[model samples]
Target: MTTRISAVPRPAPAVDLAVPFADCHITSDAQAAVLRVLQSGWVTTGREVAAFETEFAAAVGAEYAVAVSSCTQGIELALRSLGLPPGSLVLSSTMTFCGAVQAIMHAGHQPVLVDVDPATGLPTPATVRTAVQAFGRPAALTVVHWAGDVADVPALAEAAGVPLDHVVVDAAHALGTYAGDAPVGSGPGATCFSFYATKNLPLGEGGMITTDDAARADWLRKARLHGMTADAWRRYLPGGSWRYNVADAGLKANMTDIQAAMGRAQLTHFPSWQRRRAQIAAQYDEQLAGLPGVGLPHRPAPGQGTHAWHLYPIRLRLNGGIDRDEVIAALSERAIGTSVHFIPVHRLAYFSQAALIPSAGLTGADALFGQLLSLPMYPRLSGAQVDAVCAAITGIAHQGISGKGTE
Candidate 1:
C-alpha cells in the first residue's frame, strides 16, 4: 500500500510540494498562554519570565537560569561576566554559527578559530589541546554542542588546561541535551540556550543562561537589563523601591513576559515533542541508511548521551560525484526545503582575517562544510511527511553520480 503525504498540491508531479526545512511548534496551549500574557497588564519581564527562569533551570538541572533577549546576548553576557581583560584570547569552534564568535568579540575578546572532529563535526578534547598548543593559554574557551549532541566538556576543559568554569557552552541547539547522567547545563560551565523561532523550545526570540554560580547568576540578572540594580517590574510594583543604581554597563537583552509565557507553555509539553523528534530521526535513519553517497544524523549508543535532535543534517559523499548544491536544487524543485548547517567561520567575510589555532589545516571543517545539508526535523512534522522526505532523498540518491533522476 502506498502512503500519501498531505501537503500543498503542486502542478507538475501531481504530488503537493514544499516541505519547509523547519517550522515552529506552537500548540493551542501555547497560543492561549501568549494571549493571556498579552491581556495581562504586566507584560514586560514579570511573573511569566520569573516562572520560566525557575522552571527551566530546574528542568536543565542548573542552579539558576537568567532569561535574555537572545542566545547571542546570553553568550556575550556570559563572556563579559568573566571580566577577562581586553584582547584576551578565547578559543571558539570554527564550525559553529557566526553569532558564537560574534558574541566573543562583543565581549571584547579575540577569537581563535579551532577545528572540529570530522565524524561529529564538534570540537573534541584533542582539538582543544591542539588549539591550546598553537595559541597560548586562552582566557576562555567557548564550545558549541553542534546539532544538539553534547560535546565532551569535561575532557575539553582538561585538555585546554582550564578550570571547568572557564569553559562556556554554546548550547543553542541543546536545550534537552544530556551527557551521561547529567543535562547539558548541569555541568560546571555556563550553558546558553536559544529560543529562536526555529529552535526546539522556541518562544519566538528569547534565550536563557544557566549556571551553578550564584554570584554570576545575580550579576547576569542585572547585566541583562541595562545594568540596573532593579528591573522596572520591581520599581513599578507596589511598595517596590524606585531608588536603584546601575551596576555595570550592561546590554539591553532582558526577555519579556510575552515571550516567557509562550516558553512556559512549550516547556510544559517539551517531553512529548522531544520524543517525536527522536522518533522522526530514527525513522529517517532506518529509511535513509545505505543510500549510496548520503549520510544521516549520528546517534550515540545507549547509555552514552542524549542527542536533542534539533537539526537532522546529512552529508553527501563528494567522492561519489554528488554536488550538494545541485541536490539541494533538485529537492527545492520537488518542494522539499533544505539548508546547509553552516559555512565555516574562517570562510565567512567577518571572520576571514581571524587566526586559526591549528595543529593542522582547517581541512576537517572545510570538508564538512562542503557536503552538509539540513533536513526538516520538528515535532509537528508528521510520519507521512517524514516518509515523503525520506522517499525524496532515496530517489535523489538512486539518481546515480550524474544527479539525473533514475525515473
Candidate 2:
C-alpha cells in the first residue's frame, strides 16, 4: 500500500504557525546500536567500524566505504587519491557550501568556481564546461544534487570523457537520492557523504568515502588515518607488533566505532525514514506550487530517478518590492524556522577577490542567492507541521507582495 501524507489545510491568519520545518527522529534502535558498541568495550575503530563500512558501501553501490571523522576529511581523501597534480583545477559550484571549496584547497588544489543555473542554483554540465574552459584542463568537478536535483552526470561524463580523473562528488545531500536506479556514489569516481547531526542520516559528526577503485580505496584508508600503514594492524590486531610504515603525513581522521555504530542503526531505519521524507515532499509539491513567486524544489524528470529531499527550499521571487530576507524575517516572527541553503561561495570573504573564483562576473550565483530559503525537512516533521509552514509562507507572502507581482 502506498503511504500518503494527509492533507494539511491552511491555518487561520491569527494563529501562530505551529509547524516548524524539520525535526530529527532518532529511534530506540539507534540507542540499542550505540549501547552494543559501548558494551563491546572497543570505542575506537573496530568491528563496528568495519561493519559500517561494509553496509554503507552496499547501500550506495560502492565497492568500498571508508568511514571518516567528517565530510571534509572524506572530500580531502577523495581528492588526494584521484592523483590530480598540485594546483590542478578542482571545479565546484559557487552555489554550494564553503566546505567544498575549503576541502579542495586543503588537499593542495586550486578551486575552479562554476556558477549555477539562475533558475535553480544548480551547476549543470554546460556550466561545468564553462569553468573547465576558463581553467584549460580536465578539472575535478564536484557534482551536487543541489536541493536534490541530480545533475546530469551521465551526459556530463560522456561530454567531459570517461576514465574521468578528479571527478569527486560532494554527495553530502545525496544519500538516498537516485538517478534512475543508481544512487550518487553508484556512478563513476569517488563520492563523499556526511552524517552531520542535521543530515538525513544523523551520526552526530561523521562521514564516509565511497569509491570503486581498490588501489584508490587503499590509499584513502591510509590517508584518512594519518597516512600510516599500521592503523589497521597496530590499533586493530592484538600482538601483531607496532612496526609499520608511514605512507605520508596524515591526520587523525578516522571514524570511531561509536559513530559507526549509529550509522549501522540509521541504515536499518532509513528505509522508513526515507519513505516519510518522500511523503512529506509530495505534500509540499501540491501545496507550494500554487503559491506565487514560490518556486519549489525540482523533481527528477520522468525515468530520471528519485530525490532524497534533504532540503525543502523554496525560491521566493524578489521582483515584488519585498526582498527575500524580509520574507525570512517575517516567517521568523511568526515562529517558522527557516534558513538559506547557502550564501553562494563566491560571496564569501575568502572568495571575494582575495580568492578570486573565475566567472565573467558572479552574476549567476548572486542572482540565485537573493531568493533562496530552506524550510525545515527532517523525517520527524508531522503533517500538521507541514500545513503550518505552508500557511505561514502564504501569509507572509501575501502581506509582503499580495501574492501578486508588486504594483
Candidate 3:
C-alpha cells in the first residue's frame, strides 16, 4: 500500500524528525580517533596526517594526495601549482559554488562561465566547446561534478581543446563517486574532494587534492604549509633539524592531525556509509517516481560510473502552477528541511561585475535554477523518515493538481 500523509494530521511521533537538509554522521570510532589525537601531544599535521594522505591516495587510486584546510584552498593551490601565466582564462560551469570561480581569481586567472545540461546540472562537452569558441582557448578547464554526479573530464577537456593536465576537477560533492572502472580522484588532472561536516567523509573541516603528478604534489605539499621545507613534525620530532627554507611564498592551508585522525576513522566506515547512501537514494527514486510536476534527478548510464548521491535534487514543473519556494515552505511546515543546490554564478553579485567571460546565454543553468529543490539526504536517515518526506511531497503535489496548492 502507498504511504500517505493523514488529512487530519496526527500528532508528531517520537521518531518524527525535523529533518535537516544535511546531517553529520559521527561514529564512536570517529570520536575515539579525535580523543586519541587530543592525547597524542602532537596535534598538528604529523604522522596521522601523513598516514591519512597515504591511505586516501590508495583508496582513490591516485599517486599522491595532499590534505588542505578546505576544498576552496585545494582548488587555489592546484591552480597555482599549474604555473599558468598571469591573466590566463579558465573555463568552468556557471551552475557551481562561487568558491570554484573565486579560486581561479585567487590563482591570478580569469573565469569563463559555461552553461550546464539542465538534466544533469553539469557542463557537457558541447557546452565546453561553445564556451571556448566564445572566449578563446582557456589555460585550464575546471569541471564541477555537480551533486555527486561525475562529469566526463576527459571529454570536456578535449572539447575545450585543453590538455588533460590542464583539467581541474572541483569534485567537492563526489567522494564515493566513480568514473568508469576507476574512482573519481584517479582520473586526469587535479581532483579536489571536500571533507566538510555534510560531505560523504565528515571530517568537520578538511579537503584533499589527488593527482598523479609527482612534481605538482610536491609543490602542493610545500605550498599548503607556507612553502616550508619541513612541517612541525619534521622540525620538532627527535633527531630532526631546525634549519628550514621557504622555497616559495604559499598560504597556510595545512590540515591538522586531529581532523586527519577523524578522517582516517571515517574512512574505515566509508564503504558501508556509501552503500547506505545508495540505498537511501534508491528509496527516493522508487517513492517519488511518478509524482506529477516532480522531476527526479538524472541517473548515470551503464559506463558512466556510480553516483555518490550527495544531494537528492528534484525539479518542480512550474507550469503546473507550482512554485518552488511555496513547496519548500510547505515542506518546512511539515518539519522537513529542503534547499536549493545553487544560484548560477552569473546571477551572484560579485560574479556579475567580476572579470568573467560572460556566456552568450546560460540557457540550461537558467532553466534548471528556477525549479531546483534539494531534499534531505544523509546516511543516518531512517527508512520511515524517507517515507514521511515522500508522503508529504506527494500530498503537496496532489494539492497543487486539485487547485489547493500551497500558496
Candidate 4:
C-alpha cells in the first residue's frame, strides 16, 4: 500500500501564542505539598524524602529507591557504589546527554563511547559488543534510555561481557517507561530518574535512584549525604543523638523535603500525565507518519514495553532537500517550538578534547544527529496545539518537496 500526505500547502495558522518546547505543569495538589513542606520547619532531606522514596519505589516496582539532588549525581553515586577501581572504563552511548558521560568521570572512571542504532538513537547489543572488543572489557555499562525509549540494559551488559550488577541506567527520560512487563527501574542495574523542571515529573529539580540490592541501597543512602552515620533528621529530630561519623567521602547530593513533597504530589498525578503524553505522541504519529521526508519517532514492538514519550523526536530525510534547521525555523515562524534531542556527547568541545575513547565508528549517532528534531511535548499541551504543529510541519514538507525551500 502506498502511503503519502497530500502535496497541497496548508495555510499557516495565526500566531497569537507561541508554543514552548517544554513547559512545567504544576497541579494544585503539588502546590499544597510544597506549601506543607515550607511550613514543616524541616525543609531538608528528612521524613518527606523517606516517604517519597518509599512511594517512588512502589511506583516503579523497585525494592529500594534513594532520592538525590540531580540525575547527574545519581549516576555518579551509582557508579561509585560499585566499588570499581579508579580510572576503570565505563561504556555508554555516544548519543546521550553530556552530563551522563560527566557522571562517569565524576565517579573516577573513564568513559568509552559506543555507537547507537540510527533509527532508535539507542545502543544495541551489537554496538556494545563492538565497544567491548575495541576498548577492552569495561568495569561497568551505563545505558541511557534515550527519549524515554527503554534500552535492554541486561542484554547490552551481556553483549559487553559485563555483569548485570555493573549496569547503570541513565533513565533521565524514562520514569514511567517499561521493559516488557517490568518498569524501567525494576531492571538489573541502578536506574536513575530525573525530575528537572522540563521532565515528565517536574519538581523544579530532583532525581531518584532505584535498585534491588539492599547493601547498595544502604550505601547510596549514606553516600548521598556525605556518608553520614545519620542524616539531619536522625540527629536533630526527637529521640535522636547528635553524634555522627562520615564513613566515606561522598557527594552532598541528597534531595530536600520540599522537592520530595512536590515529587509525591506529582506522582499522584503521574498516571494521567503519562496518558496525556502518550495521546500527544499518537497524534504526532498519526499526522506525520506518511509525510514525505519526515520520519516518525520509533515505536517499540508489542511486549517490548511502552515509551514514556518524554520527547517527540522525528527525523528529516535531508537527502530530499529538506534541511532540518530550515524546518525548525519554519516551525518557529509559525509559533511552534522545537529543539534537538541532543548534540552527540562526542561532538561537544569538552568531550572532543577529553580522554574518552570511541569504541566503534559513531556513524549511526552522527547520521541521526543532523536529522533530529524534537517537537513540543508536555502533559499540558492541548490537542489543538498538536494539530497546529503538525500542520506547520506538513506545510514545510510540501514546500521542501516542491523545492520552495521552507521560505
Best by lDDT: 4
Q: Candidate 4, which ten residues in sequence have the lowest lDDT sum?
A: 1-10
lDDT for model 3: 0.88
Candidate 4 Cα RMSD (Å): 3.9
> After TM-score superposition, what is the CA distance of residue 155 in candidate 3 from its true location, in Å?
0.9
Each model's C-alpha lDDT? 0.85, 0.77, 0.88, 0.88
After aligning candidate 1 to the native by TM-score, how far in Å is the CA of 278 from where it should be? 0.6
Which 10-residue window of candidate 3 scores lowest in summed lDDT?
1-10
State how far residue 166 of model 3 sits from its true place (Å): 1.0
lDDT of 3 at 193: 92
Off by over 4 Å in 3: 1-17, 318-320, 355-359, 405-407
Each candidate structure's TM-score, on Cα atoms with residue i matched to residue i, is 0.93, 0.90, 0.94, 0.94
Q: Which lDDT tens digits does candidate 4 get at residues 1-407? A: 22233334445765454688889888899899989989988899999999999999999999999999999999999999999999998998998989999999999999999989999999999988788888789999998889999788878988988899889999999988888888899856799999999998999899999999999999999999999979989998889899999988798999999999999998999999999999999999999988988899886799998999999899998334557886776677667789998999888889876746554468899999999999999999999999999988887777666654222
Higher-TM-score candidate among 1 and 2?
1
Pairs of residues clashing in candidate 2: 21-376, 226-250, 226-251
What would the TM-score be for candidate 4 when compared with the true structure? 0.94
- Model with the higher TM-score, candidate 1 or 4: 4
- Stretches of candidate 4 off by over 4 Å are 1-17, 318-320, 405-407
- What are the clash counts of all predictions, listed in order? 1, 3, 0, 0
lDDT of 2 by residue, 1-407 (tens): 22111224534564444555555556688788889889987788878888999999998899988899988888888887876788877777788888888888888888777787877677776776676666665546666778766777656554444345457878888889888988878756888999888788988889998888888888888888878886763555767766778857676899988888888988898888889989988888888887777888877878988888889878887334677777776676666778898898878878765344655866777887888889878888888888888887776555554434233
Per-residue lDDT over 1-407 for candidate 3, one digit per residue giving the tens place of the 0 to 100 score: 22222244434543444776788878899899989999989899999999999999999999999999999999999999988999899998999999989999998999999999998899999988888788888999898889998788888999998999988899899898888778889956899999999899987899999999998999999999999988879998899999889988799999999999999999999998889989999999999999888999986799978899888899987334657887786787688888999999988989877846444788899999999999988899889889999998888788666654223
